[model samples]
Target: MERVIVAGGGLAGVRTVEALRAQGYPGRLTLVGAEPHRPYDRPPLSKAVLRGELDDTTVDADWTALDCELLLGHRVTGLTDVLETTAGPLGFDGLVIATGASPIRLPGDGPQHVLRTIDDARALRADLRPGARVAVVGAGWIGAEVATAAAKAGCRVTVVEAADTPLAAAVGAEVGAKTAPWYAEAGVELRHGVKVASVERGGLELAGGGSIEADAVVTGIGVRPETSWLEGSDLTLDDGIAVDERLRTGRPGVFAVGDCAAWWSSTFRRRLRVEHWDTALNAPEVAAANLLGGERVYDPVPYFWSEQFGHMVQYAGHHPVADTMIWRGDPAAGGWAACWLTGDRLAAIVTVDRPRDLVQARRIIAAQKRIDRSALADPAIPVRDA
Candidate 1:
């Protein structure tokens, strides 16, 4: 039997090994992870775990009994087809790089936090107090979620973003403009178009010589793909390790998945790296299959969800150049669907507190079918039917 070595035993690594077995690949699979703990779900790390709704005991996975060896807490210092780890030199016929990202940290003084792991969430959650002034450095998904959680815990939240609108880069201007009011309604002081110059002991300095007082600062600025170990490898790295449509890297007998992998997206016809939990979980199925001699393609509709300030935001599909924005209901009304259309077809949809609409919009994107603009704007009409 062939031997397969999996690096970075997060969701993608764990799932890929399980998938290899499920696909009848009778190979010796070894999973190496930097974290000491076993592979756990990360989405909950930001939401339920951070809010004290879940515990560490509940984060354990059910696949430990699989026919594989797990090198937990071991970091792969170098990669050469033969990895040099803290344990020793290990080799394999095939390798899968699934190392995820780390939270961006600011160089500063006291008690600043970034929620990426259980320890991080626990530390931040414990320090959160009612009526404390909480300042968030970024307005991305992580920033919004943390700010929302802080507000719910009775803390005064202030979100600072360099962009003119929050989430302008991810979701377009039209959508970002409408969604901006949620911060003020939730009692959060939203500071837009301001770049953070530096962080001091008491507060953060703004670019234009202003300052924001912060009792506790939480930075969710962004995350870079964890691919530094592959510096000597022959794999191409542009933002991430560039892989083919099958998730195979430039080298033979090697594959990459999750945030560290920049694979070709058939839906958008471009090379992209997705960092969402869903992508991390589902992309491995394709990588494993392809690695096990089954031809499989990693074509997926990008889907992600974020919960904040008593509202659930869900979106699917790629909306790079959405020329028109269509609204099914009023966001101020709490439950509504916002659709982004490129020319005539559905490019993407952001549904606030509406799961069914997001699901239907995903189907529309997958089908590559154009929806009637009027039908999409009407709440009475179902998105699937449109």
Candidate 2:
């Protein structure tokens, strides 16, 4: 490939460029990003940035040393043999898709905000003054995080979730309900099974009748792949650009990585679209290798972490909703984990305040090792030994 173009200027795009260089691809490379700022860390947007603990989370990468063209503030607008951007059309022998995902905004004219960018964090942080009434829609990871930061900032926060409990859709009702008490413990209101009809500035209209007054309303519902520009393109877009184990999008010299990819996972025996930092950080390596005529499959036991309500939550591996979950420690008491096992093989693990369990469980899942159920259940026992 004489000229390679990587779309998107997030962590995945930067890593993809780095991976290509590391694999000794001495050719012309161009990186296009929609944001004016260079690629930066995103996880901090919800935590450190939102808390006003940080202003910039820019990735520590020397764009100069990378010897590639950086087209900041240029968004990919169209695609084909010739890729079209806001700047203009450009030809490429190869392309890497790392556009990532965009937050799904609710229909509203409200003081609604979604934390996805640095600017978004800054905007939301300003409204979270002491004693400010804040209504956060959704009790998922982002919602929980925003509530935590708002409460810590002295804002009276209330979370509105349509589900019965927080994280119900993600980790299932049983495990998600285990975390319900955290909201109340943190002095935040948790309203479950309530749908928001509309978000209007200064108030939120409930599905039925009542309305909740608020100074600010934040939506943390979810995100969708940022592939609208690629519509009708050659790539197969199944929730995201469908790709095989090698990250190939069924198109010659074109590949996808990070959140915008639904890659085949041999380990899970299905396709997975993991929109997490670890996936964006690691998947590019395999994609870069495969791009450079190397035969490699990018299949990893999915992992993600969230810092909410003074708890360090880490999860590893993928298991079906029906998998038997064995509790390693008491959730009500703290420092607990929910381990899922199929037969004797470890399927997945959700850990809270138990770093060692998460650490060991990650390795065990990576190795696809069988576990001793009894030992695994004992919190006193190390996950590795278990």
Question: Which residues of candidate 1, in runs, are more than 4 Å off?
Answer: 57-60
**Model 2 C-alpha lDDT per residue in residues 95-156, reported as the tens digit of each score:** 99999999998887876999889889999999999999999999999999999999999999
Cα error, candidate 2, residue 28 (Å): 0.6
Best by TM-score: 2
Taking the tens digit of each residue's C-alpha lDDT, what string does model 1 give over 1-386? 48888898888888888778878887688999988877778787778876788867233445655678889889887777587788898978888889988877776664578887777888888867899889999888888889888888889889999898887877866677777888998999999999887777887888899889988889888898998888887889889889999999988788999988999988788898888888888888898888777688988888999887677889898777577878899776769978888888898889888898988889889888867888889887889634
State every prediction's TM-score relative to the real structure. Answer: 0.94, 0.98
On a 0 to 1 TM-score scale, where does candidate 2 land against the true structure? 0.98
* Clashing residue pairs, backbone N/CA/C < 3 A, model 2: 110-201
